[model samples]
Target: MKIAVDAMGGDFAPQAIVEGVIMAASSLPADTQLVLVGRQDIIKELFQKHGFESSAVEIVHADDVIEMSEHPTKALSQKPNSSIGVGFKLLKEKAVDIFCSAGNTGAMHVGALFSIRAIEGIIRPAIAGFVPQVNGKHAIMLDIGANADCKPDVLSQFGEIGSLFARHTLHIDHPRVALMNIGEEEQKGSVIAQAAYQLLKENKRIQFVGNIEGKDLFTDKADVIVTDGFTGNILFKLGESLYGILKERGIEDEFIARTNYESIGGSPIIGVNGNVMIAHGISSPLAIKNMISWARQQVEANAYIHIAQALA
Candidate 1:
């Protein structure tokens, strides 16, 4: 398997990203290779500084870089030679199994939709976040900062796609799907949520598990939690804040530690044609290393093909 990473995507750029790639190189399997897309001269210099040499890691030259503040669509069109653009180019050509970046979240999202395109019959593709559970496992949540506002049908599709992701990625045969809302009752949320509940119950692909509130996020109430991006993003960030807040107070909790962004590294953009992981903009070497680990698992799962087959 081949994994392509954007070397110039993060806030720390080439230095931190290169260090992370070098850290991951030591444990890579013989069959897998890590491709770093960026300026070859700088990447090579970093490798020399660390005295690292390995056949498992290769550098692919990319001329330009899309800055975080740039418009996603415009930057992509104007800078096709950017790291993110080049990474997607490799993916589109089947040169790599997955593409990952921490630089520009919007660019990553837009690039996936424009390059490989969405699965057939998909209402709207949603971004899936890995929700760490208190029971020492993780649940999949959809629409995490992808689509801020979702219609009833769009939210219902999140349940279906999210279920497939959980089953294929988490190895759950019959994953439980739940809609996130204010209350646990069927008619608790807005008009859209009430309508979404009925649609989710009627879907034969998933095992509908009624509703889940914010309090049940870490309790593993369901294997797949469905919510619009607006709510899901807020909850996801709130969960992420636990690490720093507790670290400042010198609180060490294993479960809360799992909430740290570095633990999982990246979140896959579901409903796309190929695997794409979006990491935190402030990702450190540890976070990048962890992201590569999850990228391996995602490539192995090959969830996108199964999703397309199911949709067909």
Candidate 2:
């Protein structure tokens, strides 16, 4: 399998990204290759400065870069030679099994939709985030900043998408799917949630558990949580802030440590035709390395294929 890394995407471009690729190259399977997409000269210099020589690593030159503040659609169309743009091209051509970036989240989302497109029968693609569980396992949450406002049917499809993701990536058998709501009752939440509950309840693709409250996020009550992007994005950021606060207080614990974004690496843009992982903008070398591993795992699990089958 070949995984493409956007060497220019993150805040710590080229340097941290190159370091992470080197780290991943050392441990990755001999047959697996790491393709770095960015300026060829700079990448080679970093590789040499780091005293790394591996045939499994390749570099694809992309002269331009999409700035963090640039408009997603405009940057993609105007700068066809940008690292993110080139990476998507490679993905579309099947040159890489997975494409990952820690740069602009919006750009990545836009690129995925425009380049690879969504799976057939999928109303909208959802971004899946990992929620740390108390039992040392992880639960999957969907629609995390992908579609801020979704219809009831779209939310229900998020359940199926999240369920398939958990089953394939988390290796869960018959993963319990739950809708995030204010109360545990089916009739709770807004009109959309109430309507989504009925659709999810009748859907046989997933094991639909009733509603799951915010407090139940880290519990074993649900293996997959579905919610609108607006709510899920807020919750996702809150979790990140909580981790930062705990670390600032010098509090150390295994469960809290699991809350680190580095540990989770990145979130996958599921329901898309090809594999695309989007990491945090401030991702460190360790985070990038973990993202590569997560991407490889998804490919090995045949995640997209299973998701297509489930949606079908």
Candidate 3:
């Protein structure tokens, strides 16, 4: 299978990104092809330094680099030669099975929609992030930052998709899905959330477990937590900040280590036409390697197909 890499999108740029691809190529099967998309000259030099076989790794030149600070829409429209643009092009053309990047996420999302597009039944695609719970369980949170305002139908879609991820990826049999809200009662939270809660509770396909508050996130009370992109994004940032604060305080080292971004590697954008993995911008080589492997795993498992079937 061919997996495309955006070599210039991350903070460390070509160096760390190339190193991560080399690591993945070395450990993966001999036939696994890694197409590194970025500046040709810099990628070649990095490959020589790492002593990777030229045949196994190929560099596709992209002239421009999309800066994190730039506006995503403007950048995407103007920078056709950007790494993000090239990678998405390859994905759209079926030249690659998966596209993985540590770039500006908004740009990535916009570019993906423009290029490869979303799945047939999906409305706007959702970003599914992993939340590590106590007792070695992990919960899936949807629309983590994709769409801020969601209607009742959109939120219901998140519940279905999130539950599918828990069952398929986390191997949770009959995963318990919950809507994130101010209180656990059905009448609590905004009108949108309350209406979503009612639909989820009545849906036969999912095992809806009522509303789940923020405090119940890490306690393994639910396997799949559904929230609109706005609330979900806030919780995600807050959780990351909490981990940073705990690490700085030098307390809960063991717990903090488990919940770190580097450890999680990356998040998979669900309901997209093709597989796409988005790692943290500050991701190290090890984290990038893990992201590549996870992307490959998702492709081999036909993650999109299963998700669609489960949702249907």
Candidate 4:
């Protein structure tokens, strides 16, 4: 399997990306190849400087770059030869099994929607993030910064999508799906949450576990938390801030360390036609390495195939 990386996309471009690629290349399976999409000259220089001459690694030239500040749709349309654009093209053409970047989040989202589009029955593709549990395990949360305003039916679909993802990617069977609400009761939360609860309860595809309040986020009460993107994004950022605070205080706990974004690498944009991983813009070498490794695992698991079957 071939996984493409946008070498030009992050705060630390080709240098950190190339270093991460080198680290990932050394550990990746012999059959797997890493494709770095960016300026060939710079990539070559980095590879030489790092003394990395792996046959499993290849460089694909992309002269342009989509800046994080640019508009998503505009950048994609204007910069066809950009690294992010080339990565999407490779994914669309089936040249690579997965494509990943730490570039503009909006651009990645727009690219996935326009290039491969959503799955046949999916209302809207959701972006998922990991929530670390107290028991050293992690829970999956959906619509984190995507589809901020979801209808009742869309929120319900997030349950099914999150369930399939938990089972296939995280290897959790019979995943417990829960709606994020103000309280654990059915009537709790806004009108949208109440309506979503009923739809999720009636759906037979997932194990609907009733409402999960904000306090129950890190507990084992739910394996997959479903919420509109606006709330989920807030919760995700809050968790990040807490981790930052802990680090600054020099507190080192195993579970707290898991909250670090670098440890999780990145979150995958599920429900797309192909696999796409999005790392943080400030991702380090370790973070990028883990992201590529996780992409490899997703490809091997045939995550999209299982998702399609579950939706069907």
lDDT of each: 0.94, 0.91, 0.84, 0.90
Clashing pairs in 2: none
Q: Per-candidate TM vs. native? A: 0.99, 0.98, 0.92, 0.97
1-312: candidate 2 lDDT, tens digit per residue: 999999998889879999999988889988799999999999999999999999999999999999999999999999989999999999999999999999889999999988988999999998889988889988888989989999999999999888888888889999999999999888899999999999999998889998999999888789999999999999988887777899899998898888889987899998999899999888889999989998998888868888887667
Clashing pairs in 1: 9-103
Q: Which of the predicted structures, 1 or 3, would earn the higher TM-score when compared with the native?
A: 1
Model 1: per-residue lDDT, tens digit, 204-250? 88899999998999999999999999999999999999999999999
Task: Name the better of 1 and 2 by lDDT.
Answer: 1
Please give, for residues 1-312, the per-residue lDDT of candidate 4 as tens digits. Answer: 999999998999878888999999989888899999999999999999988898999999999999989999999999989999999999999999999999999999999988988999999898899889999888989989978899999999999988988898889989999999999889898999999999999999999999998899888789999999999999998886777899899999888888888788888888888898888899889989988988887888767778888777
Give candidate 4's whole-model lDDT: 0.90
Better of 3 and 4 by lDDT: 4
- Candidate 3 residue lDDT tens string, 2-98: 8899999889878889998888787887767889999999988888887777577788899999998889999999999899999999999989988
Q: What is the TM-score (0 to 1) of candidate 2?
A: 0.98
TM-score for candidate 1, residues paired by index? 0.99
**Candidate closer to the true structure by lDDT (higher is better), 2 or 4:** 2
Ranking by lDDT: 1, 2, 4, 3
